[model samples]
Structures are given as C-alpha cells and as structure tokens.
Target: MRAAIANYWWGSSTDNRHIHWMRWGRLTAAKCQGGMGFRNLRHFNVAMLGKQGWRLMSRPESLCARVLKGRYFHDSDFMECTRKKHASHTWRAILAGREVLGQGLIKRIIGDGSLTNIWRDRWLPQHFNGRPITPLADQYVTRVADLITASGQWNEDLVRQVFFLVDAEAILRTPIRGRGDDIWAWELEKHGMYSVRSAYRLLENQRLH
Candidate 1:
C-alpha cells in the first residue's frame, strides 16, 4: 500500500528530473493532459496532517502539547530544543516539521545543513508583522505568536484578522475546485452524509428529541 501510494505520488518515470517535475506539479490531468488524473497521496496526507499540527500549535494547553513540552522541548521553543550532535531519523523528522512551520513553505531543500537565504528574506518580515496587536485581535495574535515561538522563527504576533485577510486574498486569487470532493463523496456514498458536521447534527437531534 505504501509503495503504491509512493509510486502514485512520484510517477513511474525512471529519470530523476522527470520524477522531480511530476512531484512538483503534484498530479496530472487525464485525457487532456495526456496522463492519468491521479492525486498525490503523499501531498494530500501532508496537507491533511498539517491541519492537526495547526490545531496542536493552536491549543498549547492540550495534553499532547504538555507531553511534547515535557519530553522533547522541556518547555523551550522548538529551535532551542537540542539533541545529540547526530540526531536520529525521528528527531530529524520532527525538526524538519518544525522547520516547515518556521519557514511557512516547503520550497527549501531539506538536508542542506544550513538555513536557506530565502528563509531569512521571507521570515523576518512575517515575524515583524506579527508583533503589534490591537484590543479585539489579542487572542488570535497570541495564537500566531505561540505558533511562531514554537516554530522558533520570529517573535511578531500575526493578528488573526490579518492572517485571514491574506488567506481570503489567496483563496480569491487562486480558486480551488473539488476541494475535499473525494472525502465528501466517499462519505456520502458510504454513510449517507457528506460531512461529519451533518452527521453529528443528525445524531444530536435524535438524542435531544
């Protein structure tokens, strides 16, 4: 299953450059694009799992957060947490995840040993913008600050309003069709509801009445 998923993600091309290009494009369209229209399962998995990381970074008081602080971080920010000179693969992976959160993008090459130049250029501004907070935006700003701190990037507190502002702008600029369509359609066919939200509401109504 894992090998199949990896093959689907990386494509069957033996040439390294072609494989890289296909991975970069994520997936191809069928008939019109002259290829099978397949989704990159690895990318999809990362995107979905990234939400859980967001939730974890959002809720600092959660048990998982507490455990992480006690075990790996020891209450230090992610960047401050240190292991042996040569860390294990698991440690390296965790650090990589933290680096991604710190960078806010996955464009940088991994295993480079040094932070990329683009990181310095992009991160500083984002960090500075996160600093100032108004009365109404304090909670969201604090959350962004926590994420920043945990990621060991910048100290600025990005206001939730501003974050959402950029988010809305991006959504408007680059439209996405069939977002979550596979998951929703699968659920609807199997369980008669398109989402957990509708299913939960139905159960709640039955319990109450």
Candidate 2:
C-alpha cells in the first residue's frame, strides 16, 4: 500500500534516466494491468467506513447507532471522540487491521437492480458460459450477499439518508461512470436492510443492545 501510494505520488524512473508517469487512477489498476494494485489506504479506509455511515444515516431509528452514541461517542463524531485516554493495543490493532484490509484489492460490482441481485450475481468459469460461483471469490461475494440479505431495503431514499449521515455532498452530484459506480455500489451493497437486521440480531444474541 505504501509502495502504491508512493508510486502514485512520485512517478517511477525508467532505465535510471527516463521517467514513467502514471496517474493515480491508472496506477491503482489491478496487478494484472502491470500495476501494484495497492489501494490508497486513506481513501479505502474512508470508503470502507462509508458503509457504516450510510447505515447510521439510513436508519437513524436503529438502536445500534443510539447505543454507540451513548457508549463512546455521546453525540460526537467517532473520529473526534477520545474517551480512551490511552489507546489500548486492541484499538491500535483494530486500526492496523483496517489499514491492511482497506489496502487490499477491492472487487466491486454495480447494476441497475436490487442490491441483493447485484450482489448475488456471479462471475462465470473460464470454460463455461453460465455463472458459477468459485470458492476464491466466495468470500467477497458472500460478504455482499449477506449484507444485502441482512439489510432490508435499497432505494433512492436510503441513499439520501446515508448521504446526509456521512455529511458527504458527492452523493448528491451526478454520478461519474466508473468511480461513482464503485462508491455507490459499495454503499448500497453493504448497508441494505439485511446488514442492519444481522447487526441487530447479533446485538440481541450478545445482549449488547
């Protein structure tokens, strides 16, 4: 991830003389494209958490956010809150985990359909025409599928709700073809009704809510 960010910021030199300039977007292409495929850690971190923001915004009535607010935040931003005077190793580990996971490859899919459908659709095998789920992609695919199944609804209103919750204005702007598709897909795919339901169920199971 550091290498990728460095490459994006500073162009690689070729043959110890020539300089090869690569734009941030182009440099971020998958490894198969001859790029390192490292995601910008900060950007990916924000993107990953954007789903949570979307959830809280979309479901203000949800008990999870309310509990979180009362526990550590007290109506303050999560990033700004510092209730822990000394950050524990667990907290540092969590932050490190976020950095590592966020920098890894992200596979995003988008379609003008329900979030469940978009998430459940699969990629086909090389030898077959029809889509066949593979174990390798199952982790990511299942994560999305489970999220949609847990989150109940996916509609424009939910999008707006999340947008306001995150205090992000870009969601209101016209969507860009590729970039916007990924961001929008990430939000809708992860924060649907299924996700909330699953979280609520977990909280109930743990007696945390």
Error of 1 at 36 (Å): 4.0
**Per-residue lDDT over 5-30 for candidate 1, one digit per residue giving the tens place of the 0 to 100 score:** 55655565444422434432324333
Candidate 2: C-alpha RMSD to true structure equals 18.7
For this target, which candidate reaches the highest TM-score against the unseen true structure?
1
Minimum summed lDDT over a 10-residue window in model 2 is located at 122-131
Clash number by candidate, in order:
4, 10
Worst 10 residues of 1 by lDDT: 179-188
> What overall lDDT, based on C-alpha atoms, would model 2 receive against the true structure?
0.37
Which residue pairs does candidate 2 place in steric collision? 149-194, 150-193, 150-194, 150-195, 151-192, 151-193, 151-194, 151-195, 152-193, 152-194
RMSD of candidates 1 onward, in order:
17.3, 18.7
Candidate 2: where are CA atoms >4 Å away? Answer: 1-26, 29-38, 75-209
